[model samples]
Target: MKLIVQIPCLNEARDIAGVIQAVPRQIEGVDRVEVLVVDDGSSDGTAAVAAEAGADHVVINKKTLGLARTFQKGIATALSLGADIIVNTDGDGQYAGHSIADLVAPIVRGEADIVVGDRKPGDNTDFSASKRTLQRVGSTVVKTLASIDVPDAVSGFRAYSREAAMRTTVFTRFSYTTETLIAAGNSGMVVASVPVDTNAVTRPSRLFNSVRSFVLRQMVTIVRSYIMYRPLRAFMVLGFGMILIGLFPMVRFVYFYFTDGGAGHVQSLVIGGALLVCGYITCLVALLSDVVATNRRLEEEIITILRRMEHDEAARD
Candidate 1:
């Protein structure tokens, strides 16, 4: 198996080298293991240290494009290099390199298309207490919405097969680790989690409290991204909410309308009209959103299929 390990770095010169150096160079049945570093416009010597630590390849973006895009770029680079399995981990040394084999083994053995590393709270050292609790809660919420069960959704250490890398989208800039897992659940792919030990991350985290406003914003983005795949359901839920809200007014106006005529009738008519309008607007927007969403999904699928075909043709040569 050809495995390409990806490390997305941003101002990690302090610990990137150690992360790379710690990776085990060989795993059972794995003939090749290459390291690919994605530099997100870091001013520090992160790229330099990566090379020194024995990276097989590197891709540097002109500006700090954010973690999600940098991760996507890393996977693209690794795919171009013919990686059968892609493993992504932080450059901050939070995830132990020795745990990589455990992460990728499921994919190599065909037991799963995506292997996620779950940090059991108090069972691992790589996350702060605050991060662990929030991660567990976040995973629960996401699992409920996606109809998929996941143990740890915030873990950044994971492995993906070529099909997943080709099919999934890393669209968000914050809390992308969890968002990608949600995307996998919606993408008709099988996911598996591997338990691994990580020491508490020694660096400062970019994310804060789970109840913070920023966390809500990122979570909303993730939920909206998936709504593209289920516009009718989303609209129906919104419409139902509006209907429930209008019920009180509807009931009162109906009682008054039957007892009296002018003012009560007008009020009842206005309330009903408003509810109907809201329902109509939501239905319209859902329809429009679905059209655009379907187009984007089709384009993504076409490109992925062509890319896979090219890979097969090249292998034959």
Candidate 2:
């Protein structure tokens, strides 16, 4: 089996080489292990450092395409290179490279399609109180929305089997950690998590400017992904909740009409009727969105098939 460890770097020149060199060159069940570094328009000479530090392949973007797109490119490049298994790690070197073998072991053993390296941020002394709380809340939100039990929802260190990598697709430009997990869980892909160690933080987070920004972006990603995968249920709940709320106002208006002359309560009736109409419209939207989501699923399957064919033809050539 061939394993490729792919690092997605963005201006990480100071840490990229160490991350590349830290990757294990051999594993028990793998015949070959190679490092693939994808630079997302780094101003620093991250690409040169990677190549000199023993990266087997280096893919550079002319301009920054953000993390999600860079990760997508790395996965495609690794697949084209005949990687049977793919592991993704941040170029910042915050993740311990020694845990890579443990991360991919589940995939190598055919036990899981994706294996996430759980940093256990809550237990880590390195994490501040606020960071730990945010990690816990974020992970809980992911687990609830995706219906998957992942301890670390935002971990960059992960492993994917060939099939899983081929099937994976990321629509969000912010990050792939949460969206991919939601997709895998909703699509019934096997996902497992293993405890892993982390290195000391050498640099500030480049993902977002502040904690508030991170929370907002992650919330948007989670909600968008949840709606994308489960549109019917999501809209249905909202529609019904609106209807339920409208009912309360309508009932109040009726009681006033029967007991009294219902003078000022005409406004209640208007508000309730408007809400009811909105609820009905939302339900209709739900139906349409579900149809679109179904089409998206079919398109995803077609894309996977085409990718397999293209890769196979390339292998033959």
Superposed model 2: Cα runs more than 4 Å off: none
Q: Candidate 1's C-alpha lDDT?
A: 0.79
On residues 112-175, what C-alpha lDDT tens digit does candidate 2 reach at each position?
9999999999898888888889988988988898788988889989999999998999999999
| TM-score, predicted candidate 1 vs. hidden true structure | 0.90
**Model 1 regions more than 4 Å off:** 122-129, 207-214, 262-269, 310-317
CA lDDT of every candidate? 0.79, 0.92
Cα TM-score per model: 0.90, 0.98
Kindly list the per-residue Cα lDDT of model 1 for residues 163-224, writing each as its tens digit.
88877676677656767777778777898988986766675664443447646865776577
- TM-score of candidate 2 against the unseen true structure: 0.98
Top-scoring candidate (TM-score): 2
lDDT, candidate 1, at 204: 68
